[model samples]
Target chain A: MGQEHILKSHDNELARLTDEIVRMGEIAIEQLREAMVALQRRDATSAESVIARDVDIDELERVVSEDVVQLALHGPMARDLREILAALRIASAIERVGDYAANVAKRSVALGFTPPPPQARGLGPLAEIAIEMLEQVLQAYRDRDADVAAAVRARDAELDALYTALFRELLTYMAEDPRMISSSIHLLFVAKNIERIGDHATNIAENIWYVVHGEAPRQERTKLDRTSGG
Target chain B: MGQEHILKSHDNELARLTDEIVRMGEIAIEQLREAMVALQRRDATSAESVIARDVDIDELERVVSEDVVQLALHGPMARDLREILAALRIASAIERVGDYAANVAKRSVALGFTPPPPQARGLGPLAEIAIEMLEQVLQAYRDRDADVAAAVRARDAELDALYTALFRELLTYMAEDPRMISSSIHLLFVAKNIERIGDHATNIAENIWYVVHGEAPRQERTKLDRTSGG
Candidate 1:
């Protein structure tokens, strides 16, 4: 093959891989949205559907891995090498995001067993922030916008603060009414799952920065979730 | 350099990467052991120590990534490519295992505030099983022993069952005494963290199988943790 042909094919392969990752990210975001809706509506069927669709994201992640191996066979150097590594890491992070979304859906199903507590509404804002972060990070990845990625990384503290507030609120609610303990416990995990989704989004942001700059971000963001310190 | 020299250097690099990963795994295991002790003894000092040392594992993971990039620059084909990919993945899994260990330690510190519950004793067996799985999986990775890796994968069900039992126990304990709610919630997270460590160990086991076989394990293992099902 001519040199131009080789370069063209490599570009095409890279584009395809990038597209696959974006699609995976989109599916993960959709899953999170559906999970939140299910949680709010007490729709076990929709929640179950979200759970079933998680495998699709997992399969896409597997496809991305294979694409990465194919690209690696070309023996990419320096910048290309960094992009490949970032792609692998980002895909894995997105898969975890999908898993966390599925966990939320699973807990939503579990939440269906009892009367929905008023505190269940608190999860909405947390999920909203996480979903927004996931969307922004995916765009940063697609555009290779390090600045936007950094902005997304900085926004995680917002999610953390919201999660912490809901955690304390739920604890208080559970304490006041012992009967709410079982469902509130499930809500607690669901909230934790959403908080972790924010972390995965941050991970994707950091990977994007690494891909663009060939280095890690200069400083780690301050963690605001003080629940573990209590 | 001659072909033989190149091959020898490659072998040496691979050996170095393997050794580094093993050392990282050992540090993570020790962290978990110390974290569990801190929880049992309510030693916030030891727990803080475990949290501080988590950075060492993160540093080792960064080194592993550099080693992987160097190895990839050599343009290894097929089996060597699979090994490089598996090494990157295994190192990431070990890093997460370390993070979970650190999380367990953090919650142990949080648990120190309240009087130790008798139910705290329940976490011991769960941690024991997870620690054993991690040790066996690391051995399997070092030896390239697919059979041992498969065995470790199978053993995760036992850990899951134990986690479920403990989850119910903690909930019951908290429900019985409202005063214990705060500490029990921390223990719940601690238990969840340990359970996640088991999953990471299983992830390592699966990666070892991939390295040996060049494919995922044929059949997905059955998940035994039914807590999400309510």
Candidate 2:
């Protein structure tokens, strides 16, 4: 192929790779949403379906990684190389998000067989914020917008606050009614899963920042103050 | 410089890179061990020290990454290229292990002020398994031994079992005494942090397999039977 044709093909391949990553991100979002819905409804079937879908996301991660390795063979320029590297990292983060979703789904399935506890209700809004963060970060990734990515990073603290609140709320329930301990523990774990999903979304945003700026963000992503129980 | 001299320098750089990764793994292991010790002793200072040491691990990751990128600048053959790519991933995993260690230490500080609960003692063995797994996986990476990596993967189930047992034990404690709930919750999170560290070691093992076999493991690393509570 002529050098011009080769360059054009390479560019097209990168674009296709980007498209694949976006698709993977969408599937990840779907997994999170489905897991939330499964928990809200206590639908074991839906939860199992969410669990199964994780394999697909895993396959997509492998595909993205192989494509990255193939692209690396071409010896792309530094900026392009950074994009490729970031894509690989983002794909892994997306896969972990999928795993967290699956873990949430597993808890839902277990919680499904039993009567739903009242504390399970808190998960709805928590999942909402996490899903929103994932959506914003994926969009930032597609547009290569570091501003949007930074905003997503800032928003994670909201999820963390919700998680801490839910943690305390569940503990109170378990304390007041020892009968509630088992189910409350499951709900706590589910909330943790959703909160970690937010963290993974933040991780994706960070990767996007790296892809765009060729470095980490200046401000450290704020961590939740868990110790003070504030 | 002659091509032979250039090749020799490349080999040396790769060796240096491997040495760096091994050192990173050692820091990761130390972090896990120290976090465990801090948890056992309820030493806030040591916990804070573990938190501080994470910066070193993060710096190591950045150094290894920059080296990988620089090494990539020279178009490497496929085997050498895979090694370089795996080194980047392995460093990231090591860094994540450090993060997990720091997280355990964070929870330790929170749990410190309270009277030491009986459940906190369970962490001793859990941390041991995790540290051993990390040590084995790092050795596998150094030797490129897929067999050793696979062995490490199997041993993770022991950690998972211990974690599950601890989960049940702590739940019982909280149920029996409402006053214990808060501390129990922190202990549960500490267990989880260590469990996740095991998972990260498995991740490192998987990377070793990828480096050697140029593909994923034949069987998926069996997830802990969290669903069945086995």
Candidate 3:
């Protein structure tokens, strides 16, 4: 094959590889959203589905990781190397997100027999925002859009605000009515996991910027500048 | 001064530096422990102390980082470089642990009332385990005992077990008493953060062994054995 043709084919292969990892990310988001919806509606069937289908997500994570390793052994070049490394990191985060969702779903199943509260706060909106954040960052990864990735990074604060509100509201409810404590605590955990998913979204956005540009994009700075062993 | 005298003084400086960092680690762990205890006991004084002393932990983290950076720049031998880097990572983790303690203290200050029953069950033991784990790991760091570090790694499972039991127990309490939702939820988060502190201690143990042995000493394996990146 001509050198240019060979290079073009190699890029395609890496793109396809990244696509698989992105699919895993998509499934993780879906599982999370469904888990939240299941809790909001107290739908056992949907919650069970999330629990049962988690194996597929786990398998995808395994396959994607193996593919990245295989590509690493071949001595990938600059862009190719960045693409695979980012995808590998993204998959691990996605799988962990999935595990968190499954934990939420199991809680949903367990709380079914409890004294149902008169009013349960819906987590659907929070889940929607989390999925949107994950989707946008993954799209940025696919297109190598630094601006879009940066926008995703900035959106993390909004997620944190929602999470804080959810916690406070849940607290108010529990304080007013001790009967709602058990299910409410589980719901709180599910919400916390969803918020952490937003953090993983930020991580992905940061990685996307890193892969597209050689430097870490401007971070919303932590006050502690850890100059360890500087 | 004689060359022998200069050499002895330099060794003393190194010893002093190590001792100073360990003392800093102790401060961070104390802050973390007492922050949780203050929340459990509703002692605002202890909690306030944590907020006031966070800057000192941050300052120490910076100093340790500078020392490590200077050592690295001077082109130390491979073993020395490993030890220096390990120390730097430990300093950074300790600083973050202090941040976690400060966060718990803030929550305690805001609470300003008796915690919900679910919180009492969930957070109290978790705080104890995390504080003790930090103590063990810091000892391993000072003693340079790989076996002790390995033992700390193994102790993580106990913390994980406590976390699981506490979470489930909190869930049961919440279900029985919905009024406890808000405080119970906050306590759950505090527990989760403390559980993560346990994980960070494991990380320190892992780094210590890696520094001493030049390879990560494995105990439990993670599923992500992919070829792409470490």
> Each candidate: RMSD to true structure?
1.4, 1.9, 9.3
Pairs clashing in candidate 2?
none
Off by over 4 Å in 2: A225-230, B1-3, B227-230
Q: At residue A110, give the lDDT of candidate 2.
A: 80
List candidate 3 segments past 4 Å from native.
Answer: A1-10, A79-85, A115-118, A219-230, B1-125, B131-157, B164-184, B196-230
Candidate 3 residue-wise lDDT at B58: 78
Whole-model lDDT per candidate: 0.89, 0.85, 0.71
Per-residue alpha-carbon lDDT of candidate 3 for residues B46-111, written as tens digits (9 for 90 to 100)? 888888899799778766755554443333343554565466667767877887788788767666
Give the alpha carbon lDDT tens digit for every residue of B54-166 in model 1.
Answer: 99898889878777866776747557767877888899999998999999889988878778878888999999999999999988988999999999999999999999999
The positional error of residue A119 in candidate 2, measured at the CA in angstroms, is 0.4
For each candidate, the DockQ is 0.64, 0.46, 0.14
Candidate 2 per-residue lDDT over residues A27-78, each given as its tens digit: 9889888888888888888888998889999889887877776777674664
Candidate 1 lDDT, tens digit per residue, A50-154? 999999888888778867866876746547778877898999999999999899888888888677778888888888899999999999999999999999999
* The best candidate in terms of TM-score: 1
Q: Show the lowest summed lDDT stretch of 10 residues, model 2 chain A.
A: A221-230
Compared to the true structure, candidate 1 yields what TM-score?
0.97
Error of 1 at A134 (Å): 0.6
